[model samples]
Structure formats: structure tokens, C-alpha cells
Target: MNISRRQMLILLPAAAVAWKSVLAGTPESSPNYKMSEHWWSMLIDISKCIGCGNCVRACQTENDVPDGYFRTWVERYHVSDENMTNPEVISPDGGKEGFPEAKEDGGKYFYVPKLCNQCADSPCTQVCPVGATFVTPDGAVLVDQTYCLGCAYCVQACPYGCRYIHPQKKVVDKCTLCYHRITKGLTTACCEACPTGARQLADLKNPNDPIHAFLKTHSVQVLKPQMATGAKVFYNDLDGSVR
Candidate 1:
């Protein structure tokens, strides 16, 4: 009850240091997360999508995406009978407000959700001038903001328009597939928010994963297969007009 002034000063400094560490969030959030032993992928079943935009909203809320930028987006396709190969693609405001009524109803309308494909041979990572972007062992391509030069090489190299320069951070940013949640054995925000079950997170390394069954049965294709990026996002019933 009777502490000297020197003792109080020392104890106060120690307490302040401990409080700062907690506020800084320096402790590893997930101690058990392993970079190996898992490869992440996403499955978008076109047949199941309803163009609700719930996925878009959830991703923004989870990732704190800036206005006019998107880590993931949904596009509505209008494929006419005569031109199935050249469907009209539109995503008004990244479909963040959901699609408007089809102005003209002459074609088959479907929704396609897009995100980083986690490509095994990702061009984005290849062209990063500072090696800021890299593919993790588990197949997720991630950016190291601290090392990034904001040179926009990765943005230009990406064929899918996935990477964007963060306005505030000045770093190239893209979808991490909710890596924080995945390593803790949870699905992505978009997947969780999808009301139609259109989006499914897949672990390719897991033998018991439903992705194996889906791939075996469904006619699926990755976007820009000609690029030969080994894209992990498989779309069921992907249209020819998608680019």
C-alpha cells in the first residue's frame, strides 16, 4: 500500500508497454495456421447464382474495400441464341447493388462471380518488380504490402483484372480468399453470404473434398484457359463470351 515513487514509475511504464502490444495486435491471430498441406480454390456454380449481390456486400464489409474498387464482383451475362459465343456482359457498379431488371429480355441471363483464381502459374506474381506478390505454398497468391513498390506491374500483368492498387496503402491488392478465415478452417465471406450456395470454397489437397466430385461430374472450366495459368477457380457452365 506504500510504494515508493521510483517503484510506481517502473510499474507504470511496464503496464503501458503491455497495453501497447495488445492494441497493436502483434500476437499471431492463429498460431496453428500452416502454409503447407492445403491448396485453396473457389467453385462458382453458374446454375446456382441468383445475382443477389450478397457476396459482393459481404466481401466489402469483410475486407474494407474502397469505393469504386472491387476484390470480387458479379457480372450478368446475356447470351442470345444466335450469339452464345459473344454474350453481353455487364456489371453495373460491380453488381454491389445487385443487377437491375434486364433492359431487354431476348437472351439467357446468368450471373458469374469473379475473384482471384489463385493461379499456380500466376502472371501477376511473375511480373511483380519487387517480388511483393507471391504464391503461397498452399496455392494462394498474396501480396506483401511492406515490400511492394506500388509500380503497378502486377496490376498490368493480371489478365483477370483482379489486382488493384490500394488508394490509401499504395500497394497492389487482390483477393486472398479470406486467407485469415481459411487457415482457421472456415469458408470465405462471399461464400458464407451467398444465399444460393453458388460459391463454394474448395481444398484441392483434401481427398474427401466435394470439389473432386464436382469436378468429376460437372462440365467446368477456368477463365482464360488459353493463358495456361492453371487457374484454381472453376466455373460450372462458364460461357464462351467470358474474358
Candidate 2:
């Protein structure tokens, strides 16, 4: 059938409106879209951490981390000498809540929280034979348990020894950056649970966010720079001697 010029004109406007409506309804059109660039990271201030283990408990409750496995943990480092030749790195009982009071000792003590670095060139993604491990558009590293073959390639590929195979589920699991929470317009459990506000969750893509400003104002460094993973997590006022 042949359409008249007038009929074609009428259909064109309707089609344009429909297309515009669809685009406008998408998340990309929302103000939050600009903040979703797949490069989410975190900055931890060593001085602000109180070793309270609030973040640890919050992660377990929020993500249901297995009893034996932890999505995140804190490490205690002690450096006695200015030469920095000898240092002690110890993690006592995974920093679970109700930890015993610090023993009487003569050394400097500080806690460093550790989690998935969520690298841009993530080794987990490269080692996943089934493509189960992938980086999200917003820079969050995730594992698709559905597609996982129970292989521990990712577990081994990680340099920081962060990833682990869940004992009960028999699947690899690690920190997800609270994907559900962030998508729902909420901060990460660890960030929310932090009493000192040392841990923060912000969109790196949003220049208006404090994180963006912090990155610009202060010098930050990722863990294991030689690995060249382009890690998303940054540490402010980090001691270069500590790995």
C-alpha cells in the first residue's frame, strides 16, 4: 500500500514522541546516570579508623558473608623503628566484633581495612574461564555465581589474596561493593556502619561529590602499583613502605 504525504507526516511525529519518551525514561537520562561510570572506588584514612569492627559486622549482616569467609577484613601493622626495616603485619581473628582489648605492648598500632581492589584490568576477570567474573559499567567487579564452574582460577589470580571460594555455596565470592545498596540510592554497608566516617562511598564520575574533590586535593595511591591492575580503591596518607 502506498501512503500519502499527509499520512507519513502524521506517523513521523508519533514515532518521534515514542522514541523521545523511551530515552527519557531510561536511567541514563536521570541525574544519577552521570555518576555511573563503572569506576567506583574507596578511600580509607588510617588515622580515622578506630578498629571498632563496625564495618566488619556491617558487611557480614548486609551481604551475609559466610561465617568462615569475609568480604572485607582489617589488618593491624606495627612499625617500631623509623628505619622501617622491620614491621609486623598481623590480622587477629579476622577482626570480628567483641575482639579482646589490645594487649599491653610497646609499638605503634594502626588498622588498615582491606577488600577487593576492583581493578580496571582485573585479574579475576581474566582468569574466569566461564566469563562469570566481569566488571560492571560503573566499575564494580562482580561474579556471576550462575555461570561459575567452581574453578578457583580467580581465587589464585588475585594478588592480594582477596577472592575466595565459598565453602557451602562452592562458588567464588568477594566484595561486591554492595551493588544492590548503591543501585538503590544507599551508601555501602561498611561506609554507613563506620562511626568515624573514615570509609565513604561516592561516585567518582560526579565532580561535585567530595570523593572527586578529595582525589584532586590529596595524593592517593593504590595497593600493589607494580601489578598494574589500575585499582579503584585508593588510600589517602598511605605509607609507601606498607604494602
Candidate 3:
């Protein structure tokens, strides 16, 4: 009665689902929060970002993320006049303490913050063998660590290299968009910490939300658009050189 790895992977989801059903009474952090009434997303204004690293520090403190790994990070891109398509990107210590001064000053330098896109058609959610990764009703992607197999299938499926295996918990981990705070009617730690208002929490479902106005007037793009993951995070003033 032995099963190969491939067969076992196919079988694990059933067991995980059954186990989850038994413990289905997991209480919501904010019981009054209505998932149907909102859609969560983020807007990153590349022009406003100063590479201050406040967002990175705030995310780590609020989420208690591991020292070396990052749930949210900032990358500095140096695009030269000769190489408009190829940019030199760097993120030292996940840009937690800011970046060093650029040695070559001829090119345009800017900071791009990275995090979980919380895609509507996330590959991670579809590939989770244990049914641990899933999208919420309000357009957030989350992982049930208790049921996670730490198999890294979702990690491999992610096009943006956002997901990671936790060092101690042995579960796949990534940004939850500060789900706890958001459901409680608060903004994400990173967005709140950004001094220049570089990061903004957006709710597409809310007509009055400023994001609607911003989206109407500005040109925006998502990372790796070719993957067609239905990414929720939008970048404003994104340069063509960004990868």
C-alpha cells in the first residue's frame, strides 16, 4: 500500500480539507467585518517613494517577520541612458535601513517596493497541494499555516517570488496585507508608515475611495503582467525598465 510522491500530493488535499472541516470554527479577528462589502488592494506611487525603509521596518514589526526574510521590501533601480531596458536593481537587508548612495550618478534612480500582489487568479492558491493557500471573498490571498504542508509548491508557482517557507514554522509565508488590522478597520502597517504616502491601501469596491479617482487619471501597471495573475497591487509611474 505504498504511494509515490506524485500520488501522495494528489491525496493530501482531501485529508487536509477533512481536517480543516473538523476545526472550522476558527473565529474571525473582526466579527463585524463584512467581506462582501469590500475589495482590498494596494497602490504604490513610485514617484513618491524615497527609499526611506519606514514601510519595511513597520511591516516587520507588525508581522514579526523573520530577520533575513522579508514579507515587504524595497528595491533601488539604476537605469542608465544607454540601457533604458536593463536596470541595475539592489535591495540591501531587504532595504530595512535604507540603501547606500549610488556610485554612478548619470542614470535615473528610484525605489520600488515589493510585496504580495494578492492576485485574484493567484498561481499559489491553485497549486497548493494541501489546500492551505486560498483567496478570501474580499480579494485577499492568505495561507492557513495549520494545514500548510511546507512543500513549496506555491512558492515555485509564484511568478513574483513573493512566497517563502518559514524557517521555524515550516509553513509557506508571505504578506497577509495586514489582514488583522484591515478587517478591524485599520490600514496596513506599511501604508501607514510611509512618510511620503508612497503606499496606499485601496478598496476598489468603495466608490468614494480616492483610489478610484487616482486610477482614472493615472497610468498604472502591475508587475509581470504577462503572467496574468490578476494582480491587485498597482504601480504608478512605473518605468519600462522595471522587471
Q: After TM-score superposition, what is the CA distance of residue 58 in candidate 1 from its true location, in Å?
A: 0.7
**Model 3 TM-score relative to the real fold:** 0.87
Instruction: Indicate the TM-score of model 1.
Output: 0.85
**1 against 3, candidate with superior lDDT:** 3
Candidate 2 positional error at 137, Å: 0.9
Q: In candidate 3, list every pair of residues with a backbone clash.
A: none
Error of 3 at 199 (Å): 0.2
**Worst lDDT 10-window in candidate 2:** 26-35
Task: Report lDDT per candidate.
Answer: 0.90, 0.81, 0.93
What is the C-alpha local distance difference test score of candidate 2? 0.81
Using TM-score, give the best candidate's number: 3
TM-score of each: 0.85, 0.81, 0.87
Write the residue-wise lDDT of candidate 3 on 34-148 in tens digits: 9999999999999999999999999999998999889999999999888878898999998999999877668799999999999999999999987899999999999999999
Number of backbone clashes in candidate 2 = 4
Candidate 2, residues 184-238, lDDT tens digits: the string is 5677899999999878876787667798778889888789999999888888777
lDDT score at residue 117, model 3, on the 0-100 scale: 96
For model 1, residues 48-120, the per-residue Cα lDDT tens digits are 9998889889999999999889999999988887887888889998899998887656778889999999999
